[model samples]
Target: MDVATVKKKVIVVMGATGAGKSRLALSLASHFPAVEIINADSMQVYRGLDVLTNKITPAESQGVPNHLLGNIDPSVEFTCKDFRDLAIPIIDDVLSRNRLPIIVGGTNYYIQALVSPYLADDVVEDMAEDSRISRLTDVDLNDINSASAFKLLNEIDPIAANRIHPNDQRKIQHYLSLYSTSGILPSTLFLGDTSRKWGRADNFRYNCCFIWVDAALPLLDRYVNDRVDSMIAAGLLNEVFDIYKPKSDYTRGLKQAIGVREFDEFFRAYFAADSSWVNSLTNDQVSSDDANMFTKPKLSGILNSHDSNTLRALLIEAIDKFKANTRKLLRRQRRRLNRLKSDFGWKMQYIDATKAFQDESDNSWSVWVVEPCVKIVRSFLLEQPGFLSSTGAPYNVLHLTSKDLCTQYVCEACGNRVLRGAHEWEQHRRGRVHKKRASRLNKCQRTFSVDQQAAKSADGELNSTFCNSP
Candidate 1:
């Protein structure tokens, strides 16, 4: 087989949470010479919360030279653009050394940023130094009302406006910012260039091999639940407690991890249960106005054993929510991967790890998932025929296109819910809730019409009787 390929080679191991993507990447690393792993998991990039984020241990990495793993500040908001900028250089350096860079993570957007050259935010950032952008005051940029900003975007670029949710102020601001700085319609950026759109598989930066590690949903759900239990045993609660500042922004950074925010209620209740601990706090130790009155160390020493039934119930509920959210994350990851393959023409090699996960042994993983994946990667590197075959799109694919950016649907029956793309609108229209609401609305309209007709008829009869009497 001819081994000719694109300019550079990179491998991406993608999967839902708890699918053993990192393990597979490590296993594959051992099989090849000069291999380096790049972490693409969004939450794992931030320092601390090792247990909650499920970061790979140094022992687990086994000296594979993992880059971008747990080096970021927990408070810093790491964006997709940041990941792309950081990762591109690392990938190039790996390629320079003739070492294979295997990107292992569940963060698909990070992967997309690496593969595709165009990101809307990147373009906007590049235009930040422009005179037009610099002339605007901070207040002017920050003080714009979301509804008005969205309206402005609609007037300027309706296609871009349609793609964003009205409730999503961040995206509205981003688009408006982009247009304001560049003096170009936001829609124009994505109009002709298919590569500029989401999930650009047609124009990739490297000769990429995408390995999607997946399992059956039922099995995956079970695995995630078990994994959450394992996390709890591994001191997930302790890790969360360390960073449990009351009213900490959960929207950004390491705090956005699945396990962190779920524990908010439990922690709040636990802390409030022991008011004695709060009373003992000195003003210097904790601010009088600070909501986080009790430090973790102080709380640990004082109220560790005071596990009331209410606290236990709350803790249990939090644990249940964590597991449920992780399961939801798995579903979302799977859907995104499927969309990447079907809509963007990403030729991903799907390797089912269901049997391997079921057996739950090293030997089982070797036989069922690892060995097969290693062989596939070897074939991919050698440009062999077997690995080149495309696993056709899943039957349930929405068949979305680039024009989806311009597509918008507002469901009046569903409280005028704004849905982007044809597939989403179609799904919304077909949903049981929407159907029920529409039926009820139609019935009410019909009843109103009949009542109006009867009232008019009564008035007409009254007028005729008066005329006849006269």
Candidate 2:
């Protein structure tokens, strides 16, 4: 197929965390007339997870339509295969309307699937044959352990095993299944001469462009730290706690996400009160002089005190690690880009949107401001298009304060909201309500222990060590 026959081409914006994927995507959508954004990130698909996932705000979208984002229930699973099925129709619809389709996200696998020729219709059809694959319609592959999937793949296709990375479980499984069913190796199929067929009515080709945003590691680390602080100020902890109710897996993906996971650790330490208990026990056994030996406060108070300096330090450390991981991730992305360029001769560009924005702004300054949640509530009023006064003027907008958005409350054992007051709030903290909930949650976490968690934790520790060491 010729370039013109491709009809509507797609531009994929991809990179790692703090690379400004969402900002760049929004900028591209705004600048490029008739370009629609299709969210290629797996975590951003969940609703009520705006801050943690760095989801594009409604204002950023500017009424420019977006697809496959904030639509899925967090409890349900979402996989690459599931994304492929959902995205195909959206892409077709965009092309049919003669609009440019831009797949933008930090999710490498998702963007790779869309931009690479690997997701041709026949491959998708072949994948649909397995019933195990059918069960993963709602699961997010980002939540799965790469090693587990790779192990399963190795059992099916040892030849494919030599070619696939143990950390790339998604591709390994796909190829293993393909080889097992068709008796044809995926590598051979990929290099074959048969043109991909997308049915008679939907026979279309695509020319793709890829753009990578580059940044210095230190700057990226600072950005992640600042972003995490912003999320906390935006009430991300309360939001996660609200969704992390009994037996609810909504926080599953969020728990795996960087900022969210750190916050989860903080929350776990805060509610358990185990640290406090341990401290009390130790203090009771120690002599008055000996008590001074243990200078550091218990983890419970350290975690829940909301001390600005301590929290900031923790956030910075987490971001530093995140930045190191991002560097490795970018290296992988560069390799993929090189492969794409070599095979398809696609044009690639590297633009630093953060630098561009800084240069464009007259202020030339960055500030962190914590506006009252009430202010957001107030903006909601003025945003309404039709509200007017009797004098034919727009109604004055109401801005909400932090107190209005969050009220203090008391509760008994079993975790229920009670009346609002300083007395009540103190009473709730002193009561057994939160303790019971924490105990139950601890039990639940142990009960639903997936092997994936262990693998992820091990990989995380290794990555952290590698990044921290000289």
Candidate 3:
């Protein structure tokens, strides 16, 4: 039988960056007899720099076979298509040996493309060919800046734009080019169930269970802060220094990794005796009038005449920026997980990884995490395809997403403050301050997550900010 016709079901463990995805993936491997894990995290695929990528140590893998972890050379550009193209055969091979496949990570885009193999087929191929030219012409994200780019795309294709991150310039450009070339709304093409789009294939083969290991914002925020601190203590700076101590620039793929780029500007300033390196950034001279059109975060600088204490303060600011940006990344990933269920119709079950992580000392891993997930997997194995609830009623994304009562809007676009409730957020969304920021999100911010803790509203416009002018 073709792999698509095979009844082999795979498990996907997805969540924000610090939500214990690797820990839970390992636990599931111990619970199930023949389970292998494939890394779905975009950063972890690159070889070396374990601390920055938060790579799983050998001790943590517990002898469960894991594929695609720290395997790629960092110099090569790795895309979602690269991940999907490489992962499909390995998944089939593992299933052929009667081993269960567990895909785990924070990179939902990688998981989305892997699950929907053809999702990246045209967009990515076109990008590779037009990468530089498109960087200059209409889809040239570098010329437009991400915020204006996001707003323009949102106005044109809100449905497709909903899935993209505002700061994701490449995807924004790809979608723009895709629409310009095909004249089809990317949201319609990617999210629609028609054969003309990318969705559950008519030849849909795999029995898949997507488990979202999530936590409350307070708990998750604490977890992210602590994790960043731990990574730094465990030698993240050393890993960075090994590469940048020799002065490697962004042309190398490793620099694109989150933990590194956040510190890139600061490192250049610290190492150089003069501000000569700033020239490298300004090499592409546009007309002075056009310079203000770009909205990337201004690389703040410490005064050259300032004392050592001032430079130390600048370093501290850089560290804070890294931690803050990491949280924003997790928040974006959380939104993507919800979109997987809401937009693409993926049946994602929720598990409170915080509870599981806290309950480990009580030896409740099997009880809280492994057993619950396995029970669902066993149902699929028994040909109990999960199209409806036990009562034979079809389910909606609202049913899976709406239990938490502490809903609030996190407007990174506004000022990174959590709006007290849905009404306050709706007001803020319509407020002039938010509308201005929403159009050109500062580098520190991406899109706003209004009513982040609540279920989707009836109109399916939960994330909309005011697009109309006053």
TM-score for candidate 1, please give it: 0.78
Better of 1 and 2 by TM-score: 1
Per-model TM-score on C-alpha atoms: 0.78, 0.53, 0.66
lDDT assessment of candidate 2: 0.53
After superposition, which runs of candidate 3 have C-alpha atoms over 4 Å from their true positions?
Answer: 1-6, 123-166, 173-196, 199-205, 245-252, 273-308, 357-362, 384-470
Question: Of the candidates shown, which would achieve the greatest TM-score relative to the real structure?
Answer: 1
Instruction: Using TM-score as the measure, name the better of candidate 2 and candidate 3.
Output: 3
Clashes of each: 0, 8, 0
* Least accurate 10 contiguous residues by lDDT in model 2: 365-374
Candidate 2 residue lDDT tens string, 389-419: 1112222222111112124343434444444
Lowest summed lDDT window (length 10), candidate 1 = 389-398
Ranking by TM-score: 1, 3, 2
